[model samples]
Target: LSTVHIESDNANNTLIAIGGDNVYLTFTPEEPLLLDSIVVTIAGLATTLTESNGSYTATLTLTGSEPDGILEFTIDFKDRAGNPGIQVTATTDESYVNHDIYPPEIEIISITSNNSDSTWAKVGDSVFVTFTASETLDNISITIAGVSSSYNELSVAKYQGYHVMDDSNDEGDIPFLITYTDLGGAIGPDADTTTNNTNVQFDKTVPEFSLTRMATNNVYGDSLAGIGSVDTLSFTISENQRDLNVELAGSQKTPEQEELNFITTHTFSESD
Candidate 1:
């Protein structure tokens, strides 16, 4: 070998480069030195050398499909003086220094009913809910209660649909669940919650009621004189509870009065 100037030897120097190139080694002995071999083993590839020059250099090209990490290899040499020595097996890291992290993710913060068109058919046609992450999401699997659904879309915000999970229309906000996973298999740190773009949410609360007379709904039998009604009823319901039936005690209210009794039954919900 010419000279073992690899700092670890009689010399100390740092030599590093990208791609394929030659690595230098220096040596000097009393007689002409004949070299042996330089071997390289990368994560996914291998190369070798059989002969050498007394004071020459060897080149190795690191390329293709190699895993991202350090690659180790060895260089062995023998001189005419029967001096046998091997360079410490060396390694270099394969790094994607510029690998990009995705943008902030629109975690299924929440989805909700804007109106009649609300959540998913499986999820009690109500509100959709989800969250947003500070990082991007390459893929995410969303399940409700226990049912799994695939949700792999990119957005700064998301409107997740509620999956009813079963055939039960029992009105309650129902159990809400969400999981956001990134491509690297990292989960966000935030305790996920929902937000409302329209600031409107589905209401699921213990409803209240009140009563007042819609009118002095006088009942008069076709008589010579108009008769006065004794029963006066008053009641109140939520505007959301529309199309619900309201009735008075033991009075067959008809037509117009009956229609007012049927009020809508919708709850109000809020999230941010």
Candidate 2:
């Protein structure tokens, strides 16, 4: 002649406590429990709670890398003078999430003022962007100086909680137009949502360049010691290429056609 009952302190992931304290309730010495057990299930990362006498509680802290989800758990108490009965099976859930500080890389993957459509990202106008990239994404986004060009593109990626952008063009320096996208979704999307201005200032400085030689002649600066009128000396210096990338020139009917931007451009000859 007895009844059982159970209760949960937290319906979500929590530091569970009970009765001015906590109780991982159990039974012993005959008088079986109506509900004799409880299964503590949790998601994300959980640590066992320390027990004090019959009072205790536990904590489950979420990790920065924990994914979004839920953890279901059950509690069982037996029917006794203490009403060790599962009046209503106690239930709870734990949720996990990935806090990102940076947004996804809006790597102008493939942009061209070509068709009227521009993937929505306008040229001069600024706008916010968003994405769920994992962990707190803070710093991510590349600038093209508000200057538009075929060589410019946005690249967003997670190198180490950092949304990295490689605005590398084959040739010429593109004015850097930066729009920081941080902890929202992707890189730019996130930054757009949180920032006051969408697109900021542009890198106005035009890159410098010089002509070097790359040939097979030998007499002058050719790699071969003595084959042609070219010197056996090389004339290529490892350009700082810090912000430069390698690009191939596109074909055009006229020499005035737009030249593809690239970092390195070599000339061939046998002159002194």
The candidate that achieves the highest TM-score relative to the unseen native structure: 1
Q: All candidates' lDDT scores?
A: 0.39, 0.30
Q: Candidate 2, residues 207-240: lDDT per residue as tens digits?
A: 4543434344444544544323332112222232
Candidate 1 — number of clashing residue pairs?
48
Q: When superposed on Cα atoms, how far off is each prediction in RMSD?
A: 14.6, 16.6
- For candidate 2, give the lDDT of residue 7: 26
Superposed model 2: Cα runs more than 4 Å off: 1-39, 44-47, 50-56, 61-68, 78-272
Residue 147 lDDT (model 1): 53
Model 1 per-residue lDDT at 180 = 54
lDDT of 1 by residue, 1-272 (tens): 22333211101112322233223322333355454433333332444333344343333343323333233334555556667655534423322111112323553355555356354232344343455666555345565444554443346544344443344433444344555544334344433345453222334343566564443333453211223333344455434443445444333443233422432211112310
Regions of model 1 farther than 4 Å from truth:
1-108, 114-126, 145-170, 195-240, 243-272
